[model samples]
Target: MAICNQSQFKPISISPKTNHLSNFNLQISRSQTLLKCHNNNTSSLPTKTLKIEPLPLFTSVRSFAPATVANLGPGFDFLGCAVDGIGDYVTLNVDPEVQPGQISISDINGVGNSGKLSKNPLWNCAGIAAISVMRMLGVQSVGLSISLEKGLPLGSGLGSSAASAAAAAVAVNEMFGGVLSESELVLAGLESEAKVSGYHADNVAPAIMGGFVLIRSYDPLDIIQLRFPMEKELFFVLVNPDFEAPTKKMRAVLPSEIAMSDHIWNSSQAGSLVAAVLQGDLRGLGKALSSDRIVEPKRAPLIPGMGAVKNAAIGAGAFGCTISGAGPTAVAVTDNEQKGRDIGEKMVEAFWREGNLKATATVRSLDRVGARLISSNS
Candidate 1:
């Protein structure tokens, strides 16, 4: 949904000063309450025994797509949501005779074949999903292969890689007679998250399953999937500065101990944002989205003219503007595409005027549909 309305909204209070990060030990206690919320609900169906009837050992190709956003506003590593516009598609095929634990990249095309996926297990979303699927099913000798069609930009904070992991997991599960439950797949995606940036599923979970998801805790796999209220139009103007910020570097820059006051401020803002979305208060939602007190300030400086771009977007009637992902890329939310386009133009103009650099911005509607299985071929 559009985070802000073009004419009706204005940025209320914004601090342009760079945040002074404190170096201290910050231990975020895992809250299993998030998980309990999902499992304890009476509406949820009880786990059913698998009615396995093996038809054939032949190969079947399936596709899965996931929406993702890491470092969503105040939560940093903890908060992420799957937007509709961007994601990854994975086509998986199972070959029973190929032996279990065997994975071959028969034909790697498009987004993930830069040899980067081959380097580290974490960076390769496909690899992580494969590992998780195998581990979960206790399969040791089934051969498999995956093809990825990546629609999202890599390193744009769009959960491009996480989409691959979610897609691969879903596709693999379907190929295996849907043995892995939805929760199991979510857990698998979270496990794969460790390959890239520690372990978290704020992005992957929602990407696998549509709608707004709250990751209350990661350990013991506590994932809460909540349905976002309908009647909201969440549009995204994703502006890529074509600059890359390492996720690890951004993590390192985070303040270990935030002031209790700042923490409260962020908490209120987050809560308000959530409420705004639920209430279908587009104006309020926009205001809340831009009112991030935690990471944006500390991280904006890394993007050359982020400050100017943000100001320009605000000037151009954007609800709020902030860096997308770790940035170089930024986002401006508006009620309509035209406003988003105008804001994007202003953002690029601001970058040029202030940083003497060129930037690109693409506008899209918020994707309510997370990931889906496109096809299965025998």
Candidate 2:
């Protein structure tokens, strides 16, 4: 509805010197010797019997950062994107005595639930994923300490939790000489997610592989990476109302059954939205984005002034407005950061008027690069 037009795009760069998250250290590598299966193996050792070796200590420190956005419109539990605008960091160091099954986290920084941080590896999704990946690779005994730096806000619909889980899994894999494939790492990441958000691969997959992903199936997990094709400039504004709406609560509110017409409409919109993104058709994408017939309407009422905020963003030149993940936070797309800021201001104003609640809005861009190895100097 609301569209903002401006000329300048903000300069985006990655900075390494400044530490936004708490510093951490650790390493994951394979065991050096193979276990003998039988005396016959001395003459013809089976390939499976090959000894797993521990990777040499990292030549330099390394960091893995992942960008993520949950509930990408109609594909609740089935779609997500690695947003370049925000992410989390994992720093690890090698400890020969640390053993693979053991993982310790220190230097927990950023805004996170302190109680959640204090838990052991078995309870922490991120820690579990990291440790699991290492063990599966035959690094049975890894000794390392991890420092998790959370950049995204907790429970803000920004996928902060997923990013942390993804980054840890990825960083540990890379630290261990890349023992796992991209998809394998995603599977490991989802193991952590299952502990909290149930068995969902949409968010974790994208965070690992990067780009726009379509979760075609869940059980045997099928994922498709969609290319972003846009001729016109595109940007995003993230506005979190500083509230928490658990994904579980939102999913519970959704109807397990939907009208035939609603299903057809939502399917069409999802298909069209994917096509529009690939075609670089901003207007079509916007229309499709706002065309969710199943989830938004039912859950919006729970988010205070969602309607007013959406209306205000549209009025202020946002291509379209939608709940960021579940509820509370809203996302607006525009051509430039300047317009995004303006739209964010208007959206916040609208929320104040309708729900009498204050909200925070930030201008951002689609993160095309996804999760990346920023530097090895952990």
Candidate 3:
């Protein structure tokens, strides 16, 4: 993880912005008034609504969590957004017959190298996350069995480990009757991420909470859900080179201390980006997204053809382009789907032309729903 300058942390200052809040509040008030009128006119009304029973304790539960793009250029280890269509699925089953406090990895598939993974709970991201959730919830007697289905490539800078950890945490929480809140589940996922990557919620927070998330502070683990312009047609272009950029290696290349001017510039850019997103200023957002002076300059050299790829993406009509997380993957933002696709293809072509590396590119929307239970069997 890149070290952030905490002394420069400041609130984003923006003018008051209009959203759908007034319309939503108006609709709620009208509905309440109509309900009151109906009750006054009716002789009798049912006071009790139908009660839906909760499902019985399930032996197994399956969940899926979307891939996330962290940093977003300037907000290192703080800002993240969940991307649609690519993610990881995990199934966690309770084994009552097994010894207490035991976790087993029954199966792993989809990103290759299943045989290379360790079965121990302490080693595997999904297993460790599931076990952490169970322990946090005080479910001591139930043993856990985890199965991971990787939809995203490992070490591709697409929050692959975070997705698995988040899915496992959500699956285990669902199997245990959904006792854990979203924040608690995020913390469980963070535990696994800490073991594998580093103790940062930039990826895990959005993977669990969905959409855009800002990690305000790590001391108290403050996560704020930021609103995106849902009315606008925003798309993401993801280009992944056929190579791996290990998170540790990426972090190792970054300087331990940054210049004060660089820190202030990054802070201002990040704040502007957040404010633009909140204000629905797409043009301002694009400028802010493209302005990253600190991390990207140091990390771009590590990724082959990163400079050309970003230039191609911008030339093809993307709002901005930057390293997705640690790199080997580059992300571009656009308002039109066709433009996003074009940007993706251009990025892939640039990667091949510049570095002779074959890459894959895809355009996807933002995933608003984060980790969710896809299936369950009691």
TM-score per candidate, chains pooled: 0.79, 0.83, 0.84
At residue 330, candidate 3 shows an lDDT of: 95
- TM-score-superior candidate, 1 or 2: 2
Residue lDDT tens for model 2, 178-279: 545565667777788888677787777788877677777655556677777645567777878856788888878989899999999998888887887778
Better of 1 and 2 by lDDT: 2
Clashes of 1: 16
Model 1 regions lying over 4 Å from their true place: 1-58, 111-115, 119-123
List, residue by residue over 46-91, the lDDT tens digit for candidate 3: 3332111122268788899999999999988899999988899998
Write down the lDDT of every candidate, Cα atoms only.
0.64, 0.68, 0.79
Candidate 3 to truth, TM: 0.84
Candidate 1: worst 10 consecutive residues by lDDT?
A: 20-29
Q: For candidate 1, lDDT tens digit of each residue in 1-378?
A: 111111111111111221111100010012111111112222433343221112212376667575565555665555556666566777777755455666655444564324445534434777778667766554444677776677766666777667878888887766655544555667777777776666777777777766666666644455555445666676777777756677778767778899999999989887776676567676776687677888899888877888898889889988867766666577777888888888889888888888777777787775566666677766
